[model samples]
Each structure stands twice: as structure tokens, then as C-alpha cells.
Target: MTFTAAALIAASIAPSISNAAVKSEGMKVSMQLAPTADARQQVLTQSAVQFSKEMRRLWIEHILWTGSYIVSAISGLEDQQQVLSRLLRNQQDIGNLFKPYYGDAVGNQLTTLLQQHIMLAGKVVDAAKAGNTADLNKYNAEWHKNADDIARFLAAANPSWGFKWLQDMLYTHLKLITDQVVARLKKDWEGDIHAIDQNEAHMLQFADVLSDGIVKQFPKQFQQ
Candidate 1:
């Protein structure tokens, strides 16, 4: 990729702008050092796309297996800490991906929200396992509330990622997970399979939505 004359000029000019503007707008003068403008754009665009891909893969793994792990733990077939540790690591990985874009402070905030989500999910699993209907109801509500908070945080960071859409998608995610948990508890094999299928499809779409939002919001950085 070769940097065009115009790109070189713009990149050079960016630094002379105010420090606050440079930080807030994310002017990437270094990116213009690439052989071509498209090369830099490709790197950034692909990174954003891969962020969604990695997150989707991680969450899909959670959706597919976390419930089963919880079931096993509850039945004394597995250790609950193993599941929590794995999910926590995954959440940290997801959070780190955002650090390049949002910086450490905001990235850690996202990680904390995500950690809470995983913890609330664990509580839901425990309540269900114990067959404590009241606790089950309470934890389930909290889990969804955490999802709302996550959605709000994301929407605040990137207005192009609509609050309503993210909220709806995240709520749908929680509902699908709930369906799977309920089905498994009831031994409804058909329902469990259906919920898994729906979740896999929906989760991929959610990832795409986030990726698209990033591309749309930062078109200048992505355009060749």
C-alpha cells in the first residue's frame, strides 16, 4: 500500500491541530506511513471487523457451553470455578480488544461491566440448579439489567450503535440463553436444541451489527 500525496499532506497536517482534537478525533498520522492509503484503511477496517468476530466467537462459546458447564457443576460433575475462570479470561480478552480504540480507562470499564454480566449469569445458573424459583427469578432479572447497562455503555461510546438496537439484541441474547437453561432444566431436548440454533444465528448477527456500526461511525479511517 502506497500513501498518496494527498494522504501524506492530511496526515502531516493533523498533528498541528489541537491536542484535544487529535485525541478525540483519533488522527492517525502514523497510518499514512504505510505504502498505500488502502493498506492503512485495510488494517484499521479489518481490525474493527475482527473485534466483532472475536467477540462473537467468544460469546458463542459461552452461549453454547456455559449452561452445560453450569449444569454439570450443579450436579457435582464439574467444578464451577473452571467455568468462571474461563469466562473471566474471555471477558478480559474481549475488553482488551477495545483498548486500542477506547483507551485503557474506558476499556476497563467495559471489562467490569462484562465481568458483572458473567457473575450474574453464574448466579442464575446456581439458582436454577438449586431449583430456588425466587432466586432464579431475581438473578435472571439482574442479568438482563446488566445487559441493558452494557448496551447503554456501548451506545454512549458510539452513537452510530443505536441504544435501542443494541439493547434489543442484548435482551434477545439473554432471553435465548434463558430459554436454553430452562429447557435443559426441564429435560426438553427439542427446546434446548432450538434455542441453541436460534442463539448461534442471532449472535452472529449481533456481531455484524457492531462491526457495521464501527465502519459507519469511522468512515474516514476506513475509506480508501
Candidate 2:
């Protein structure tokens, strides 16, 4: 499912909006003609496949870096900040994916939300490390609230992404993260490894849902 250089260029330059021409006030001039429906559909199909692959790659990186951050942070390792920086960048990358179909503002908004999600998770890790039960409970609650905010934001953007379903998916993702953290804290090495495996699989599924919804909602933006 690789795109050739020409195909990549075509997708890059394709119109973000629909092909329909708009009329100016008191003017009857026609704009540039659009591709035929058949041609447009073919381009969209190719682009959609590529988008799915990209989404999967991004989500895989998200979980892998997050796991790395978790390990570094919990063990008081020096690379914690570096792993966290990479993980935060992944959030921005995920947000940028929406800019083609939505816009920069929306993309930035998603990036902010996702970064907050990561930061809050870090707080949770810190609390757990310090044996601060009160802060752990507080940060955990805040973390779930951030997840809710993310689900709501995405559901608002695409009708295909139902709020409840997105919420449940996000909550499950949080639980998986929590599982890994708890397993690490308790010296349950097997459980931590299993949690990482589950988290990767779950994030991939999450990526697919988002990719499918975007394709279904704005087929034109995916032109090859």
C-alpha cells in the first residue's frame, strides 16, 4: 500500500474542498472545471487507503512512545523528558492530519487537547511514583475528564463518530495505560508487557475508526 512519488504529489495538490464552482455576486463567470465524478472517486479511493496506513503508523508511534515515556518516568530515568517530547510531537502530528479536511484552527485545537492528555498522564505517573494517593486520585480524575473532552471534540467534528462510543473507546485506552502503570509499580512484568500489547492493538483500532470516519465524511479531500 505504498504511494509512488507522482501519486504523492497528486494527493498533495488535490483540492481540499469540493469541486463545485461558486458564483460571485453579479457575475456569471464559471470557475475552473472539476474532475469528473468517476475520476474523483478513483483518486479518493487511493488516498483513503494511504490515509488509513498513515493513521495506523501515527497511532503505533503514539503508543510506543507513550510506553517509553511511562517506563522512563516510572524508573526515574534521564530520558523521560526526551520520550515525553517525542510523544507530545506525535499528538501534534495526529492533529495535523485533520488540517486537510478541517482547518488549521481545528487541527491546533486537537493538538492542544491531546497535549493536555499527555501532560495529565504524566502527572498521574508522578503522583503514583511519589506515593501520593491524594494527587493520584486527583490527576486520574482529571485525566478521564480530558479523555471525555477529546471524545466530545472528535464526535463534534464527525457525525460518524458517536460521542458515547468515542468516550468508551477513550476510556478503555486510559484503562490500558493505567494497567501498564500499575503493573510496573507492583513489579508485575508480565502484566506490563501484556498491557503494552493490548494498548497497541487498541490504538490501531482507534486510528482505523478515525481514518474511516474522515474518509466517509470528506471523500473529496482524499484525492490522490
Error of model 1, residue 196, in angstroms: 1.6
Candidate 2: tens digits of C-alpha lDDT, residues 26-46: 212121322112322333477
Q: TM-score: which candidate is best?
A: 2
In model 2, which regions exceed 4 Å deviation? 1-44
Worst 10 residues of 1 by lDDT: 20-29
Candidate 1 C-alpha error for residue 79, in Å: 3.3
Instruction: List per-prediction Cα lDDT, in the order shown.
Output: 0.62, 0.74
Cα lDDT of model 1 by residue, 1-224, tens digit: 12232133223223322221111222212211112213123345565666556768876775655665646654566566776687777777667766767789878988899889878877776666565656766776677778889989998987666666666666666656665666666666787687777778766666655556656566665454
Error of 2 at 155 (Å): 0.5
Q: Model 1 shows how many backbone clashes?
A: 5
